[model samples]
Target: MIELSRVPDQEMWSISFGGDCANVAIYCARLGLETHFMSATGQDPYSASMRAFLTAEGVCDDLLLVHHDRLPGLYAIQTDASGERTFTYWRDSSAARGFHEVEGSAQALQNASEADVFYLSGITLSLFDRNYRAQIAELARSVRARGGHVAFDGNYRARGWADPAAAREAVASMAGHCSIALPTFDDERALHGDTHEDQAIRRWHDAGVDLVVLKVGAEGAVVSSKDGTAERVPIAQPRDAYDTTGAGDSFNAGFLSAYLAGATALEAAAAGNRLAGEVVMHPGAIIPAEAMPV
Candidate 1:
């Protein structure tokens, strides 16, 4: 999508390519992973520019299918007083919504399954129809069944779901298939009303997640594994954060980068916090490439 983040008070807009999965793909590529993105794009100026942006960031765009009828998707972010954001999307009739309906969609999904890590989110599921969601679910399960890591984030947004029931179903499916599950406490509370954090944790574990990390803003992340081990990891050094957009996406990328490099789960969570902290210190979905930690 063509991302336009409104600069509060200044009435300025910073335009770029943005989306949760795309953000993760960029961060993963920068963190030394071979990440390929699969989606549909319209043959429009915005799509052209977004593709160029992805290429510039070293994320592969060969998997994108071109659509002639629909235009590209666009979203604008409105940041609040506390660096939180409210998003409004023009994606309902977007070309990318039919990504899995394209002829090459299954081939793309099957090809991506060979990856060492298969990463996706609830948003990805929400974008597609029932059949496509099934394809995604099956792909994730296949990845895990083959001993590959399937990383999932229930980056739930009620607005994206057709209804709360659909959200529950998709999120539950991903939770059941992921090897590493990353979820926010607020999202869990909104979706399931789990009184205690452990309730959410237990739910994911029971659903088949071998490792789960519950992100509690400021309080840091609580990490748990199927072996009954759990602990809280503090955030990395705080920064003068300005925007919280893409913080979770970057955290997942950083954590995956560290974890793929053989770090312990707790160490990976620390890595996630470190990157997430850095991400919030900047505006928009992506920080300036020069500002990224080495």
Candidate 2:
């Protein structure tokens, strides 16, 4: 999606490439992962610019499909004084919504099944129909069968669903296939009536998720492992955020990067918090590469 972020207290908007999965993929690549982003785009100028941005960020685009008859999705972001953001979307007819119907879609799914980790969010599931969503779950099963991890973040957007029941069913379906679950507490409370982080964790574990990382904004995250271990990992140092746009996405990237590097869940959560701290200090979803901590 093309992101148009309104400059805080200014009458200007800064344009950039940003989407939930795309943000995570770029951050994963930046964290030295061999990341591949699979999605669809149009033959428009904004699409071309997005492609260029992905290439420059070192994110592989081998499975990106192009459709001549469609256009890319777009969204605008506005932030309040506290740096919390609100968004307006214009993506009903985006090329990515036709992903399952694209020419090379079958081959792309085949290739994606061989990945070491398959990461997706609730927003990704919202983009497709029931059949394609079932296909995605099958793909996740195939990846796990091949000894890969399936990570899912239930980044629920109320506007994306036809109703709350539909959202619940869709998110639950994906959660069943995920070995690693990263969910925000607020979203869980809104969607599932999860009164506490423990409720969220219990739900994920009951759904067969092996690792559950429940993100509680500001305070930190709660990590639950399949072995019946649970711990709360707090932010080392919180900052007065400039923008909270990509905090969760960046945290997912950092946590996965560290976990894949053999760090324990607690250690990985610390890394996630550190990276997220840096991200919230910036104005956009992505900060400059040089600004990234070593």
Candidate 3:
């Protein structure tokens, strides 16, 4: 997706590449992970630019398929004084909608099955129909069966689903296959009517997720494991947060980088908070690589 963002009272927008999973892949690559991103894009200039951007970021674009009939999605963002954002999208006919149906997708799936870790978000599930979503779930299951970690983020957007029930069903199905569940408290509240963070944590645990990190915005996350232990990891909010975009995506990257290197879950959450803090200090989903924390 091409993102156009404008700050409060601004007339001009800054164009950049941004999609939930794409942001994670870029950050993970920058964090020294060998990341591969799989998605469908158009044969347009923006699509070409996106592929270049991914390659430059050290993310493998071998699985990115080009669709001849559709264009990539476009979204515009507007941020308020608090750095919170609102988005308007033009994605009904995006090439990514053809992700599962595209040519070479089978080969891509076979390659993805060999990964050590598989990660996706609710937004990824929403792009496909029931059958395609099942395929995704099967892919996650296969990864887990091979002793790989399956990470999931329920990044729910109400507009992305046909209804609340549909969103709930899809998220629940995907949750069952995830080993590491990274769900935002607010999204859980919206999708599952979870009044408390514990409700969200318990739900994921019930779905057999091994680790659940419930992100609570500035207050940080609640780290829980299947062993029945839970802890609150707190973080200081960045005072100069210019935009809140990609906070969770960057957090995922940082957490995964640490956790995969054998950091404890609590330590990974701190790493996640550190990177997320840095991201909000900048303007877009991705900041300059030099701006990253060492």
Candidate 4:
């Protein structure tokens, strides 16, 4: 969990744990994957509680790197009458920013080597400084070069990037390194400017991505492969969404879970849609465990 605080101008809303990678890790665990979160958090009471929560949720804790001097990151979400959401973040000096900057970097690299798939997002990339960012990217490539799969989500937030060109370059460079692309069409449209889903898939395919799972919001998802094949998979059911938070992450969890278990890409996408539809009907990213499907 990300440990958030919600505040409004009239009443104030403050909430935490809206990070994309953390949400995926949590959902992966709930979906029966042996998941581990690789990120930095403060050694404070709140961070401790956050670790406790993940441990209680059955996620592995050995990979969680704790910083004693810094504090955990925080963000606030503001929702208006039309149900639109905006965010204000206070994470400039958060512990996670210093993740790859650790002294014994070999230890961090060793921890990363154990995961079957290293799932990360554009947000995770944006959190790092230049040198550390390159190191992380190299690590991701090394993971895949060794025959381990890498999954990427282009969870782009324009506000998160200091330089738009840097963001584009980073994303383009890393796109090919991943085995799976869990792309949200909305974000892809915003980043690349009005490209069709086919064009987007082609872009990744040309860059050497083996698979692309293009999420089209309520339209469900489309799967495309490098071998000139494509298919559309609709959401399992029509839904009136309550909140769309964590829908993509949970979808990644469901889809990856099914894929890892040997389901077809289309079948995995259906699982993703089923999970996402159920999530949007409830508030927050992590819904009740009992509500999850088999």
Per-candidate TM-scores read 0.96, 0.98, 0.97, 0.92
Give residue 209's lDDT in candidate 1 (0 to 100): 91
Ranking by lDDT, best first? 2, 3, 1, 4
TM-score preference between candidates 2 and 4, better one = 2
Candidate 2 C-alpha lDDT tens digits along 1-294? 999987766899889989999999999999999999999999999999999999899999998999888999999887787888888999999999988778999999999999999999999999988888999999999998899999999999999999989999998888878899999999999998887788889899999999999899999899999777789999999888888999999999999999999999999999999999999988879989988877
Residue-pair clashes per prediction, in order, are 0, 0, 0, 16
**Number of clashing pairs, model 3?**
0
Candidate 3 residue lDDT tens string, 102-162: 8899889888988999999999998999998998898899999999999999999999999
Q: What local distance difference test score does each model get?
A: 0.86, 0.92, 0.91, 0.80
Stretch of 10 with least lDDT, candidate 1: 234-243
Give one digit per residue, the lDDT tens place, for model 4 in 1-294.
Answer: 353433333465444454788888888888789998877788888888888877877888777887777888876655455333566778888888877655544587777866678898999888876777677778788889889889999888998898678788889878878899998888888888746888888888888899999999889999998895889998768787766778899999999989998998999999999998888766566777889876
What's the lDDT of the predicted structure labeled candidate 3?
0.91
Cα lDDT for residue 292, candidate 4: 86
TM-score of 1: 0.96
Which of the numbered candidates is closest to the native, going by highest TM-score? Answer: 2
Candidate 1 positional error at 260, Å: 0.3
- Model 1 score (lDDT): 0.86
